[model samples]
Target: MDASNPGEAPETDETLPPDDPVVAPKARSIRPLVMIWRQALKYPAQVALALVALSITAAATLAIPAYFKVLIDRGFSRGGDIEGINHAVELLFGVVVVLGIGTALRFYFVSWLGERVVADIREKVQENLLRLAPGFYEENSPKEISSRMTSDTTLIEQVVGTTVSVALRNTLMAIGGTAYLFYLVPQLTMWMVLVIPAVVIPITVFGRRLRNVSRTSQDRVADIGAMVTEVLGAMKIVQAFNQESRERARFNAAVEDSFNTARRRIMIRAAMTALVIMVVFGAIVLLLWRGAVGVASGEISGGTIAAVVLTAGLVAGSFGALTEVYGDLLRGAGAASRLAELLHEEPAIAPPARPEALPVPPRGSLSFRNVSFRYPTRLESPALRDFTLEVQPGETVAIVGPSGAGKSTIFQLVERFYDPQAGTIRLDGVPLTSADPAEIRKRIAFVPQEGVLFSANARDNLRYGNWEATDDEIWEAARAANAERFLSELPDGLDTFLGENGTQLSGGQRQRVAIARALLRKAPILLLDEATSALDAESERLVQDALERLMADRTTLVIAHRLATVRAADRIVVMDEGRIVEQGSHGVLASAGGLYARLAELQFGATEAA
Candidate 1:
């Protein structure tokens, strides 16, 4: 990002640190000033108002030092009249009042700009994340996303809210003061001009190191956050394993890395600070010494020396401020670049320019026509290869397979979570890829393993499947899932709060609640992925009865690890290594003594074999 100073060149990629040395060795190219300006330009009227206020504030500040020049030289010089001093003092007081008001207004407007810009950047980044492909999250963590929205935005807020205005005010003041110095002593102003580069050089050059350190520090902080989130989310597992000390040690190391990087940044900033202060003030002091000698030799009046000194001091202070602003620009530039990468990433899955709409009421006839799929990261092995299947509407098909036999892959493809690399999946004879993914998902209800639940009321959790469901409808769904009995036993019943991940409820209870949510969806198609796995024998019997009833008139896909679950299924498709090994009714498949028969006899024993 180009900074306020046009003369100082911007840092290139070679100056920046890489995100990861092995995977993403190349540094990212992102211009933060572009984001800032884009946001600033969004509210042009507000920006205009703030800039006007800033201009008035800068003018007021420049007037103060000029007022002091008149006070010390013309008004209070030796042998000057006391009345002149009194008049000068009144003028100075008036300047102070104007400055006080200007500074206050400047603070209000600049801070407002900062807050608005931060909010816009955060909203944009979030929207981008939502549209991003699943692959993006696979590489980055939720912690990294959180950090970008928070700490990175805070850095941007500092740049927008504080640094920009400070730089502008000081810049104007410095220019005005220098002009005044030239009017008082043209020869002396030339020496002051020579000192400007001395201050600018260190801030520009050393600022590159600061930016690199800031990026590293932020990465370390994000690592710590990721570790904390992972451990906390699985606190039960962590405690069971007695890994508290291990987790703490990892977190401590992450924090120490962050601290070390921050220290490096601080050292560079401090050095830059010391350099600016010495170079600016030192040049002024040298000028002052020359001015005093010139005054003694009758070359200029005491008042002239005094006025020149006052303007030079104001200019010097402005230069010092510029140095600090330079550092912020560099640091903020890195932050902006990282944010832009996330915001600009295009999702691999996107709605077609003109997508075919689903039937208002879908008839769930599903077919896989020579469909093949392989995750992009694992392109060497196909998860599903030329898989072909067809089910008439309202048919219940059970899928039985060992692990990694493309069972889950089928569910994902059916829901349009991923597109098949070859051929197509169709719904009601229309290609699934051509249909809107949202439309396809809306017609399907998925009950995954382990029963995912949010920290919300029981009623609210069920209502998620059908947001507009009435209270009575929610109860009906719960009753169908056999959840109403336990729910009614609770003190608050439907209004009872389910703690995080439904931790307050037993495993069976959580599973029942999940089944209730699926029942509420009333989707034409149902997918059960070991939906009864968490339930105990009694609960499973009851819930299985409910699930059979739930699947009566809908097209259903069942992935069962247990043999008992598939006994009532219309047909069982046995799969091995991503291919269908056998397919037939359960009794027939068992009688045939194939893969299904082997699995069935393993669970049901010789009873099934006989």
Candidate 2:
């Protein structure tokens, strides 16, 4: 086992009945059936319709035995009227029609109800997932969460739409058929019902085993799904590294693991079905022998005997079918339990019950005082310690530091992605904790290093910065970011579809689009984190020119490792090991022979500070 990830259990063909958190978490009881069924009740009209149709179908099925009894005893016996025989045959055909129509109606309503319920569940799960904070994902892989959304939800859809409906219809048939058996031949039915205990005993025992195994089986399938998602999402990485054979081996292992678990579940369910059929039919054969003796003595009519035998078959058949349904229900229960766990995950960050409003016309000032923080996933290492800095309105302050010096940490703190373990952070003189995260984020425009763009059109991608932006405004921002020329070159221009993650564009082009997005935000503060790090000289010069104009009236914090990029900052702050070691202009720092001077020496050589 890899000890680093306690949450990710090793994948194996043999797993315990229920996994941690998926079905039973921290000793908390999970009743997925009850929870899922209660949700099914949300659509009252559909539930009622399904119930009515189910009842009609059951009644029609029960009436078929009555028709058989009438045809034999009243119409086919000695001295029987021909007219009576014809009427009995017609009545039998009528009952057949009723059964078919009722069955169809029952199926329609039940399937419709199942589909509607599952759709609502999917929507709710996704909506809840959106609200959870990053810490939740630190422990849970996106692959697993996505598996729950697709594989698990598909299982639930089957359970809700098909399994539940079949189980209900069979339940009604079994009960109604058993009662009709008694009315047909009390003497034979008395002896026949005795085998009920025999059938019930094995069902109870095997069902427990199947339910446990079903949970494990569903978990294994989810593993396969998670693996597929992970490998496919990084297909380029896998091919580049020439790990295709290794990945295929891993994928095959997961698939076989899932299949093995399912095999066990299927075996258990099959055993249960076999035991039920053997006992139920064995009892019926004995009942038939007794009925034959009773008929020899004229104790029961032939018609009654026939109906009793048919009804007994119905009872046994319904119970046998239920064994299969039991497995599906258990699988569904496990899925619902997993979804419920996700829904219950509490986010580390949430809006206050009544958040204080931000100051009108946001003043572009930011401050951090004696702040300390550690990322949740890397709690052993501090990302920031005793960090203190202040940026005045309309000032461009550039932070220069080596890797892991907490340059990006400041941006995260300002964005309220994580709260500091110690000290306070404020914007516009209001503590960040006192205001809603949305309000704080709205006042600062952020352009991340990677320049993330969605699989969407150019217009939609740019409009993401300001959803309500007009066409003219979008074009205006694109022009300012030096992206309008390339955008117009595309066949469909703004409406052109950018492939996944904007794969159709070059790195420099993607960066320009990201800048355009931030420019369109029109916020009071701008955050640029190595935005020009990956650009070529030509792209850098052009982007820097556009950036100069964008930063003219806004407070800007720039993180740069290329000393030349930030040489013109109003003030440069040098940091190392999460603490600011020097603060000054380019000339002042170079002449003092400090850490900044040494860094400049390494990048540009000894004799020149330029």
Candidate 3:
């Protein structure tokens, strides 16, 4: 385990910037399903195979009822010709065996196709999500994204893999069985057709209602998932404040809303089932009475009556399955709509029509020319107003200010995390908006305020910064960040498994790991937001010394609250209310008695200010 320095104080709110405004929520749309399916059809061979299997299965299922007809008319009837009866029985058994074999192969092929399509969909969604701008994550919860990739994809999977095939096969069987019944007894078939209106009309109306409720239920479930994830991720504060009851109540309420919506859906489905059974069976019994009269009058043989009965039974059973699977289709359609909305969203940050190519190895020069930006959630005032600054190649600049002064917004603009609404930012004399954001970001490294770690080993975490780094290079970067000593001390050293979000590691240790990541990148530009704030005075000194060495030939932008860190900067820029209020050497700014002087005095006291 890495040693903890409890003696080190946590950074003040003044050091860490306020959370940015919430991203503007968007209404869900239904275009993505079409696009997803269109892309999925690129694998025509798989889809065609699934369709072939489905067709064969449906044909075989319908063929089963014909075997029952043969058994009833040939094997059960004593008046039939004995030699002809035996031959018919033999043929019936042979047909059933052939169909049973086809059923097994069809099931296997369709199921395999479902799995493949789901895997393909998830891979495409994840890759597109990764390509999205940082602004995408700022507005959406990780849970919301995960739900689309997981739960929504599962819905599509069921639809493609099972429900769709079942619906189609059952539909074919229903149609084919109905046709066969007409051939067996044309008079009884008319009654079945007459009852169709009674069943079809109610189901069509109620099924529409069920589909809407399904959509509401899915959206509510997603809300519950997202809320739980956000709160559970911050469980430390949730536990500290004794807010478990509150969170439980909140989650229960969301879940209850989903339950209620789903209940409404279930009620509609139940009603539809009752209507279908009542209509179809009621017609069957009425038609059987007519058949009984015909038999009494000797209009049809006992064997013919039995054959018609068997076909009628097949028709009713297949129709019932079709009705139920139709409800699943409605629900699946609702899920498809939700997933489609995410896939269709227009990314807030779009690349230029003809993006300018960035230099292979970017120079360290960075500049902001009258840049101004307002977050999508807040349009009242810009986060950074007419921000103008320039850093020479290989110069280190520290940005310091009071709360809400737009200190971190500068780094956001520099990294093109958000493009300015007005004016421009440039790297190596090329406008950031014109250059590819991906290309520009490749030249920069960021150490965020909170050290975000994936669930992985220490070595794996360090390697994220530079995937091609050799083991020696990774260890060297760890040493430069002052993290190698603690990493080496762990029981498993570099191979030691870290818990989710690196929860197993101390805050300072996580911060050191983040530093090691930045060092590994070895980009021409480094951006740090309270990189050493998690460490004790002693550890801070050690890590700070290492950071200074790492920053030697890179263009560095640091957001600092402590006067000590500002003093090490080659130049200091003071900002207030989204505007640059002061820019000079720390000593010069302190002597100027401007915003920087007051801020330094507020933190260091009047004696230190002197």
The numbered model that scores best in lDDT is 2
Candidate 1 local lDDT, 197-235, one digit each (tens): 887777767776776666666666656666677888888
lDDT by residue (tens digit), candidate 2, 1-610: 1212323433321212344334343211235666567778898888898888888888888788787888888775899877877897888788889888888888888888778877888888888888876566766777777777887788888887889888888899988998887777776788878888898788778776776677667667767777887788799999999999999999898888788888998898888888888888888888888888887899988988788777777877888787678767777876776666666566677888888888888889998999999998789999888998988999999998889999998998899888999989999998888889888989989998888999999999999999999999999998887788999999899999999889899988898899999999999999999888767888789889989987989999999888888888999999998899999899899778988999999999988874
Q: Per-prediction RMSD in angstroms?
A: 5.3, 3.8, 8.0
Flag regions of model 1 displaced more than 4 Å: 1-30, 78-82, 298-310, 488-497, 608-610
Task: Write the candidate numbers in order of decreasing TM-score.
Answer: 2, 3, 1
Q: How far in Å is the alpha carbon of 417 misplaced in model 3?
A: 1.4
Per-residue error (Å), model 3, residue 563: 2.0
Summed backbone clashes in each candidate are 0, 0, 0
Off by more than 4 A, model 2: 1-30
List the pairs of residues colliding in candidate 2.
Answer: none
Q: Candidate 3 on 452-539: residue-level lDDT in tens?
A: 8989998899989899999899899888888888899988988999889898899999999998998999899999998988887877
Q: In terms of TM-score, which candidate is stronger, 1 or 3? A: 3
lDDT leaderboard ranking: 2, 1, 3
